[model samples]
Target: MRENLTSVSSLNMAFTDSMKPTDLSADKKGIKRKNWRRRIGFLLKTNSSQPILRLVKNRSYRPSVDDVNQWAQSLDKLLGHKYGKAAFHIFLKSEFCEENIEFWTACEDFKKLTSRKDLVSKANSIHEEFIRSEAAKEINLDFHTKNAIVQSLHAPTPTSFLAAQKKVYSLMENNSYPRFINSDLYKELCAAAKGEGKHIKS
Candidate 1:
């Protein structure tokens, strides 16, 4: 159990509070603060969700209203968006279940390898880190899926981890995804996106 974003309540507060406009504008410090806010606002208003880091331009990233709304619609929509995926990852880390997403992402990356050598190496690494009996970040898997992955590792193919990956994805979708949707972190994000003033820092 690593200390995740939510575990640091103060940092989480700082991130959510970053969305609100600062109460300064009379002195040089105030002027600088306003400029910083403007720059960050500009970045958030961009069409793409590329800048989803909670630390916007150093200390924050605000998802647009659309982004937040779509996340609530389905797990697919949430994971499909880069910002959504990043936010979910942070949420999962807080829950100490980040291995699910991590393994899924590794499987996705593994599928893109063209060379057999690269596939074999990555396959073995992913297995040792995640699929082995006592892996570093072992994920929940049925005995059948686990053994299947072990067997496939010797002559790894792009889909070698497909079943295991699907299982992990299903676990997140059924368990963590719902919790994430109803989490304080998510509520704060929604508030920031919908609130008059918006920003984030962590």
Candidate 2:
């Protein structure tokens, strides 16, 4: 009976030893899964927080226009208003031609740079990303404008992208601006603004 009992104890010890590696492996896998979940959660949290960042960085202030008629009166007037710029940007994005406005805005900022170092650096980056062949955000340009920009690259100035920028601006003014003025989004904004004005007057 003693020998039988000893044999049972030995079997139990062997079983426990065999389970150790499997149990450890399962624990490791569980930890890995938890870490993966945590990483995904972190990414989701970061992505969700971006809108809050935009809110903080971009002022909530909308240009107050007493009359919505001003927007329809002139494209220049519409382009000058903050709401108009935002609406136009959205429209450009919808059309997949956002690079036109983006390039134009970049040129505006580029012209404001005081440092030659910054000018050179920004010019190279902009040219590569938006003007070079098969660029990620290449803007449509005539051959003359393209050639001018390529020549300017040899000695980049604040106005290195001026020709290209002008072309993009013209494109927006002639093409996108007309569409934006007629878009449902613009109509909605106009309606909302008019409603706000009426509410205030009352």
RMSD of each: 10.4, 21.3
Global lDDT of model 1: 0.69
The CA lDDT of each predicted structure is 0.69, 0.57
Model 2, runs deviating above 4 Å: 1-68, 196-202
Error in Å for residue 44 of model 1? 8.0
- Candidate 2 is scored at a TM of 0.63
Across 57-76, the per-residue lDDT of candidate 2 in tens digits comes to 32333333453467677766
Model 1 clash pairs are 15-201, 19-199, 55-59, 55-60, 56-59, 56-60, 60-200
lDDT of 1 by residue, 1-202 (tens): 2222233333333223322123333563444334333333333544433344433444445678999999999999998887778667766655557788889989989999999999999999998899888887899899999999888888999999998888888899899999889876676667768874545432
Q: Report the poorest 10 consecutive residues by lDDT, candidate 2.
A: 11-20
Q: After superposition, how far is residue 141 of candidate 1 from its true place, in Å?
A: 0.6
Q: With candidate 1 superimposed using the best TM-score fit, by how many Å does residue 192's alpha carbon deviate from the native?
A: 1.2
Clashing pairs in 2: none
